[model samples]
Target: MEHNHDNIKLTSAEVSYLWNTYLGDSLSICVFKYFLEHVEDKEIKTITTHALDLSQQHIETIQSIFLNEGIQIPQGFTEQDVNLKSKRLFTDVFYLKYIKNMTKGGLATYGRLLQNIYRHDIRSFFSKCLTSTIELDTEVVRLLLEKGIAACPPTIPYPQKIEFVHKQSFFLEGLGRRDALTGAEVANLHSNIETNQLGTSLAIAFSQVAQSNKVRKFILRGNDIASKHIKVFSSYLEMNSLPVPMSFDQEVTESTESPFSDKLMLFHFGLMIYAGIGNYGVAISESRKSDLVVDYTRLTAEILKLSEDFANIIVANEWLEQPPLSANRKDLTKG
Candidate 1:
């Protein structure tokens, strides 16, 4: 006989993943709904609708799990956070690419979460998440290729034979590294450049529409940071004569009307900052060349500073939500 899921309490991993998933999907729902309002291409709209449905369904499932466990349902983003009537701030191409980029993040998160999760129910849910995100990612890639907007990575010559590194210089660089970038390094650099492009576009769009001066300034600073990071990463690819991805800045419209609340905008930036940090962390660990590691480390510090500023702004606005925590033994014993 199968043990009842309710009879077993959720472990820290389970609770944290569920809570984090709720937050991410809630944010996605707002962003996707806003995208759906402005998306005009038929095929793009269909995929956007599918993405939105997945987020909504995920939110409902999480809510049900939390309520059944007697845990408080997080007041994730809602209608109040979005304005469907607001003017379009991005082009149809931007909408499609945005969904594509976001699904990549979703796949990574769900896949990693599955590694630590052991509960049957939670595992099944995240397993479903992994599968659905894979579907979304595959669909978006096909459309991107079909519509000729993929900005696909450069092709390298076929390997003639297996090889091994024999020199210690492969890992050492006193002034500047002279070794050609490995395929892994090239992949990480290319992916980072693409991510920063998306970041730059988002910063520009958010800066234009944010109501508060502080929020606008923060996002504009983020734009500069993302742009600088893109250039730094792209130079490595260019030095190797590899093609760089195209910019999405032109896809953002000139509209200054805010389609999302300041709270939601700040919260979204926080998510982006953390996600960027995680990406850089992965790049750093996977990297073998000394300079690439140093550069990634330096830029990661910059992003860390940006995350600090985000914390200050979000806290000042009182928009940050507290996640579930261990019981306060000290509080229980007090007075």
Candidate 2:
């Protein structure tokens, strides 16, 4: 049935995007606010300020949209969720790396959101978000380069001529010897290693400061998972004699005081788990080696199980905010 354009309502996809975006930005605001409080480097502080401003603006924009649609606004993270005065949990260099990783994730998210949105306004909003994230990513890269901390991907010698694979052995698992890694494979390995490094570092910090014993144990388990994944990815690089990316575990401080509420910390950890699954999915698609694919597939399954457990924790704690849902005709009939 054709419906009037003026009467069009928000679709489930659009509502889901908005709900997730709101939660992400709310968490970002709290994180950046805490970073701004203790950041010592002038350059890092400036970027941190810009990031916090963007998150706050996003929250306001999303709130206005929710109000207009008569949808109840999600009680996302708030001041009570963050203790800005708590001791610094990470170094300035960590902040730089965090923002850079966040920008990369934002680009991926907004790109997917743009593809899902049908309403003109929703599409336009996501387009703007994508553009802003691109700019932010550029700035972070420039700063990282200037500071000499950016790990540029390994450079390969220029090819003299075009070449093609001659046999199925090219894709076969090597028992004694293997073919050299392709640029795409190398890139995926490096990117996944870096992502897992960041996740491990964050988990370390969260584990130290988490108040609830259950939450602390869960966070520590996450740290162990991230560490194991890093090793798995790094082994591939090592077999090829490629340098592995260094872990950011040393960047975490010794402070045991909680910087964020247990609820926010749990949500933040959950978000990282979701992002990890997406990263692994992309890596598996880009990878061609049979062993590599098997490894990622297994690791992804393990993380999925952990994520399910994390969801149960959130629900038990009554911290899982419900997303917009379609009306139930069966319930309506009973009423």
Candidate 3:
């Protein structure tokens, strides 16, 4: 229970961000509990239990840090914000997808914080967070496989050249088909699934949380893109009888304004898009003789482009958080 306030400098915004994350962790505990009790799948239930335990531990750790600093705790969303008793309109598969997506958000947030914060105590907390979130992500994938819902994208051999949309006509006029299968195609499909999940979650969250007409319209476009990708992936998954990740849960509201700031919403979108491109790229490199890689590559390109557009919106709204860098004139640098 040692308090070390002397070493680290924290801004109000940083403090607020930590507090929000803490609250989110707390809420996730409750959300996971709901899933554990309601979900019929045993593997998913175990994953939820493990995630809940980690989130509970994180909440305690953050609370202890706040207490040490003598900072008043800010209230977070409560059961009041969630309608637990509401009838189940969406499948547990969608709930699991949402859980997976939320962990990605947590990973991005804490990973960035770990790189930026100078304080030993705070950095240590974020380090734990990053590790825990990664574990949760693994568990999620495990559950997906156990439930027979995991999508297996086809792979391709390396000797055969794979054609990508970008490499082809700018308007997607000509595409070639390969005969042999390769492992890289599976990687690409896996990556597409990950990114598609993120986009789907963002659309659902925005439909439920946003209050602005303009913002909702933007979110709607995002939803369209995500839905289209999900359909394509679902078709592939269905061929193997792999449970398709749920698309457009009725639980999410289709609204104009949101509870979160436009900046936060767009920032979250940007991070997911960034991750999406890398995930797809990995698949492209690992895919075999399958055409799935080509499809996902096209989707990745689209997501990257859309992500850049969203980034511009974030910048225009002054929502982008500037990273730490050295001044051109080092002598003038001051703490």
Candidate 4:
């Protein structure tokens, strides 16, 4: 099972991972290129360079795999998708935290990928991806701590002794006010808050530079959505006397000049929306209380709608790329 049998062709799952990874990395390249152009802090620049290098390498490797398999490459973002001459959109501090969030997400993505990826070479590729991303994550975290900007999760007092939940009301319904949050629940809440905080910053930045009216309005609405979600998530932590994660809206600049094409910006928003939806799904399972589950499910549905709107905008511009699809059985039968 460890060695890849060359005779074995790739399953749909394997192809899906590679195809999706290719698109994500390609988008990262465009964003990082714009970051590097205006990034001032030496420490932030160092990690940004490393991140850009990693994305470039990933694109090359994925290209090699697709060519070898006779699969057509996805038309992901390219140089034309970015405009280097545009003014800076984000601050140096934003760049540092952005990498931290990115690698954190990358670890989750590449780790989950290993479960479905069976080919030895493909598995090995993602394994290496996990390792490299961990290294980047460490570097970003260390820098954040050194700068004293680390938003460490709230610390709860240790229980004197292990106790079992004996009450049925532990799964609170309307408000989780009855019982204190579990460790897993707190982690999910803080993580989601942080993600929304970052997303709000992105929404503000994107809305400032987006050329199209539709794209601008979508991202502006996204800012309101993220801010609203942040407040909801924060209230839970507040009720528990845990400090809520801080927002990064100030980290964005006032520049209105577009650094990325409208297509790229919209695509990035879609990616963020999808990730938010995925996080909500995970939070639903991690949460023990019914109210928390209901909240996540409701929020996920709202974000899913936002994702659909982004898809529509992308499609309207003819900028959406098709993923690998199975054969049309109806067409085959018609012939």
Candidate 5:
């Protein structure tokens, strides 16, 4: 490969965006393709098809940019990473939920990418991706609503008067308890609970279908962790006399056949763990209750440890894909 770009070279941020987008979209294609094969609902199938199309288009666009920049195209996930012939591992409802979850993630990822990218072309491309993801998310939400499968956040009574916090007791911790929950706090709690519920269901499904014994055990452990986290979040809402989101554990099937490779399953789980940490960090920052903040801080640490263990497993199995990195100055000097 040669440096062919005349003057417009890719900055580190641009490189990162294209590289990660390519890798993620490649994996999405594999997952969506597998889902399309097993989905029975026509509406769900249509959504899956659209998702697949968008992922494939992203791959093509990313490949062109890499080629033009004289950068090596990443060997992302392929058809070989998925088993389209495998038996259905999840129910039709699960497919819809999964799409909704992934689309939400996609929107966040693209928004962050837009902030980092300075190139007009790259920004335009990501803007388009973000727009498409928004549309897809809307469609998934509509379908989930129509089918009566969406677990909406609990409604709260509208505040009648503009009130200000006048006491330090609002940030009470330990023995002291806060009787009221702010709308922002409630929203974060509900969102975290919903995310954990989905994570628990996914872990269960992966545990059942993972081929390697170690991988299966790891996934089972993750299922327990997610379940425990859900309980913690739900308890917060329950104490406030608020309803909690329902779990999707029943949406998984008893299929022992693997729909995806152990590598993909582990990688996907690792991504969820990272996302969980980020979500918890946000919750901790926005929460006024010291008890809630402490809980999120402890939970984030626990998940960080789990993520490290996951990385070790991937490295041991030679399944971890190296991300973009700067050159080692020490190594360069020795060479």
Candidate 6:
């Protein structure tokens, strides 16, 4: 392998980000292996097993990079961070949705890393990882759709026929300035990683026994979403030459049984989706290029739909949160 020996040096920030990603990937595969043990669906198990293998390979590659650079790699979290014995606590549905969101985050994060790496070998390595991550995300989505766990993006109803008004307008001319000024929005992107970690871990714990094919696919899709977001946010810090915040400060509690009530779980997910939307919105607004906005916009929409569907499930189960307003409007009207 060709290595860059020029003036190029790995900063602590860069190393930290890479280290976090390494840990994340390692944990992901380990969790998948646990999922593999209880999944009854052969096809889903096969795909997960393959994904786990790829994640293992990725960890080795990253370790090698750190070793070659004489940089001491930090020992990140592993399956030990998860309580494997707590596997009977939740429904498979909850677990799968969690995984899909996480994977989505990983994909975005890795893709951003590929964009900023300068060294030839470094760039090549990240490129390979980025491509693999995207492939896995696509596969996860496909599996979700096949199993009917994937939520379709909402579409506006269209009229059968419409009149055309061919007029030129500068609608977007000043709107970009007005809407793009979320520059002061202090979004803790690292918070996203932490939330995703907790969510995915919980999902993996339940997925061990929840062998529903639909649930497995949902978990995988969630994993992709989480992965992509991690990479995306990491890029912003890298661009500023700032540190990648890896606050695994929070303790992980394993619950195979769903500790959260169904309504609470749905609400929690709704909060995460909105959080993701805000983060991506900031990224899109702050970005100077079109492609960046386009990417964030696409992911934001996906997450939004996932959240809505999860909410739907909650409602069907009669586990929905009580509305802030009265179930009846009579009380408000009378007051």
Best prediction by lDDT: 1
| Residue 166 displacement in candidate 1 (angstroms) | 1.8
Clashes (backbone N, CA, C under 3 Å), per candidate, total 0, 0, 29, 0, 0, 47
Tens digits of per-residue lDDT, candidate 3, 193-265, equal 6667657766777556655565566777777887788687666655654444444354444443334444445
**Residue range 1-335, candidate 4, lDDT tens digits:** 46745588888999999999999999999999999999999999999999999999999999998898888999898999999888988999999989889998998899887999888888888998999999999999999999999887889988899899776678864533564888889999999999998889998998888888999999998888888888888888998899987777899999999999988888888888988988898899888888778878888888988888888888888888888889989999994
lDDT tens digits, residues 192-297, model 6? 5545555555445434333344444555566567766667755754554544544221223344354223333333445556557766676566554444456567
- Cα-based lDDT at residue 239, candidate 3: 62
Worst 10 residues of 6 by lDDT: 177-186
Per-residue alpha-carbon lDDT of candidate 5 for residues 123-233, written as tens digits (9 for 90 to 100): 778999999999999999998899887878778899899999776888975446786788889999998888888888989889888889888888888888888888888
TM-score per candidate, chains pooled? 0.97, 0.95, 0.56, 0.96, 0.96, 0.50
Candidate 3, run of 10 with poorest lDDT: 165-174
Root-mean-square deviation (CA) per prediction: 1.3, 2.5, 7.8, 1.7, 2.8, 18.0
* CA deviation > 4 Å runs, candidate 2: 1-6, 174-177
lDDT of each: 0.90, 0.88, 0.63, 0.89, 0.88, 0.56
State in Å the error of residue 151, model 4. 1.3
**Which structure is stronger by TM-score: 4 or 6?**
4
Point out the higher-scoring one by TM-score: 1 or 2: 1
lDDT of 2 by residue, 1-335 (tens): 44344567888998889888998999999999999999999988988898888888888888988898888889999999999889989999999999998998999899877887998767777788888888888989999999999976776668999999776666776633354777888988898889888988988898889999999889889888988988998898888888888777899999999999999998988988999999899988887687888899999998998899899999999999888888989999994
What is the per-residue lDDT of model 1 for residues 62-178, given as tens digits with 9 covering 90 to 100? 999999999888888999999999999999999988888899799889888899998888888999999999999999999999999997777667789999877767888664456
